[model samples]
Target: MKESSLFRYAVVGLLFTMLAFSCDSEGVINPTPTPTPTPANERFLVVGDSGTILVSDDSGATFQAVTSGTTATLRGAAADADGHCVAVGAGGTVLYSADSGDTWHAGSCATTNTIDRVICYGSGKFVAVGEATGPDPYGIFRSTDGGQNWDRYAVTVTLRGIGARSDSQFVAVGNVSSLNDSALYLTYTTGASWTLYSAPSANFPAGAGWLYDAVGTSGGYFVAVGSDGSLYSADGGTWSAGGAVIGKLTAASWCASSSRLVAVGYGSGGGVSKGRIYYASSLGTTWTEVNPGTIKFLFDVADDGNGGLVAVGAAGEVLYSPPPADVHDAGSLWYDGVSGVANELYGVCHVP
Candidate 1:
């Protein structure tokens, strides 16, 4: 072949090789839309260590945290019948809000037990429970004046959380007491009395898991969650395993009817992605995940009363709000989509 022809072919081959390399070389594509997003017209509060709690009243659409001055790690929160909100956490942490998280004040943890969870029913009445530290440990405390003053009741074992089907009928759960040291604590007197109860363990491929959270619904149903996909059950008397049905039920709530249950937990083992909502009509059935998922860590979820669900969690996460037409039925913000947290969100509530 002629020298000129050979040079032309060489140039063409080099150009082709360069183009192929450019196409194959690892380079970032536009980042996939973060599954965690703020929904329009929804509200959210991001919880973190001593950081201002971020609040978004317009659904997960926008957010603002109180910056006056505070730096306590809030772990749990709940709303009252009038929509007032209360939060609790570290440093004997207890917080209250009259303007729906617009302003906050540290209440009191009653004991320095690392109060991890709290719930409010109404009439300035609230019950908060957490891990016990020293002697006379493991209990649920009551607050009558909107968390202003607390009365702590001592129990033998540690309780992770407390819930009530009514003011008189209450339930709390932790490790079930066994010769092996596993125990679960339950009460009927709104913590006026606590009894050691046994429930089915969240049986893992390896071993039984630890109980993390629990909620009691109207009628005669109660559900519990634990590590590595463990679930437990209590139907007034019997304590049985709810099974390893859901992936990670970090936070859950009873809604719709006594039969409808919604749970938000995550699967993204790395960080805060792959969050999902698992729904169950009944507690005994295995839970199934909701589709069209995003990288969201649905931590704590609640029924907003108008047919929609509100769940909050890590990474400033809130479930993006539903459509505008559904607003009335949806009721309030943070009703069903995952969101992003500047820090971490452990608790949220609507103080109405």
Candidate 2:
């Protein structure tokens, strides 16, 4: 009876030891958790000159042109969380897509000036910036009703790029006609008022040059890129120089999945101009250029929402980098997707 009891005790102690070894620090048994699958219905919209709008349903493997209802050279596009997209362009064009780029309809814009850039800050709020024109010549337009209608705001600078950190906080970058230098404007009142910042300051000194595009990140960082490969960073308030690249950067985007900021533009080499792309892990401290292997000028790039990137540019060039888009690929991983039209593509957005 004593030997039997000793064997049972040894077995019980061994089982307890094994169970403890298998338990996590929180005293719960650890098991492999299944990862949530990414939705397969994600869409990519690329808009460009001649009112060309292209849609890709299969992760940018192929593209088909969709009628934008007007041939006004759409320049910029943004998509909200609810699948609503707004594209802005020349002649104050404001096109809205409720069905995620499948169909588009014109929205009433108060200004006749060309709207150069547009950003959708969820909940149906969108802000667009462009060249000065119309009776007021404000250059800033805001839409609160999913871009159905807009209201213009007055600012002295010709705003080319606009980015939003929130519905009430926004930053715009462009050039001052008189100064011939870059200009920065901030609006915290939902476009009700704006504060101007320009060259000749401690943060943005003189000779800063003109800025072309701006983008806001999920981490509350804003970056504006422009002439001579210049870059500027902000935290929704203060502004500072974000270093520069080797060429002119026309547009920038934040890839949340990879935590990288990608900027696209054109650079001159051997007296021939070709597209340029650069990636930075942080705001703009350091940059690494990626050769896209094409001579076309890349105007805009957007995160694929799955750790990849899609860039569109001159001659309807559409480039895609599949998942795990490591910057170290040295341009070998980029694939030139088929965009049907030959028109220049200026803006791109991913709608999930």
Displacement of the residue 164 alpha carbon in candidate 1, Å: 2.0
Residue by residue across 1-352, what tens digits does model 2's lDDT show? 6999999999999987776444322232332222322323457889899898899876565798888899898999988888688999998899997887788999998777888888877667888899884465768888888888988877777888887667778889999877768887888788768888776676575566788987776567777788855554655445566766666888887766667778889877545678887877547657666666588999988776666667899987998766653643322245678898888999988876
| Candidate 1 per-residue C-alpha lDDT over 128-179 given as tens digits, one digit per residue, 9 for 90 to 100 | 8776656647467778777767788776666666666666666665654342
Scored by TM-score, the top model is 2
CA lDDT of each candidate?
0.58, 0.77
Q: Cα miss at 21, model 1 (Å)?
A: 36
| Candidate 2 residue spans exceeding 4 A from truth | 1-41, 234-237, 325-332
Q: lDDT score of model 2?
A: 0.77
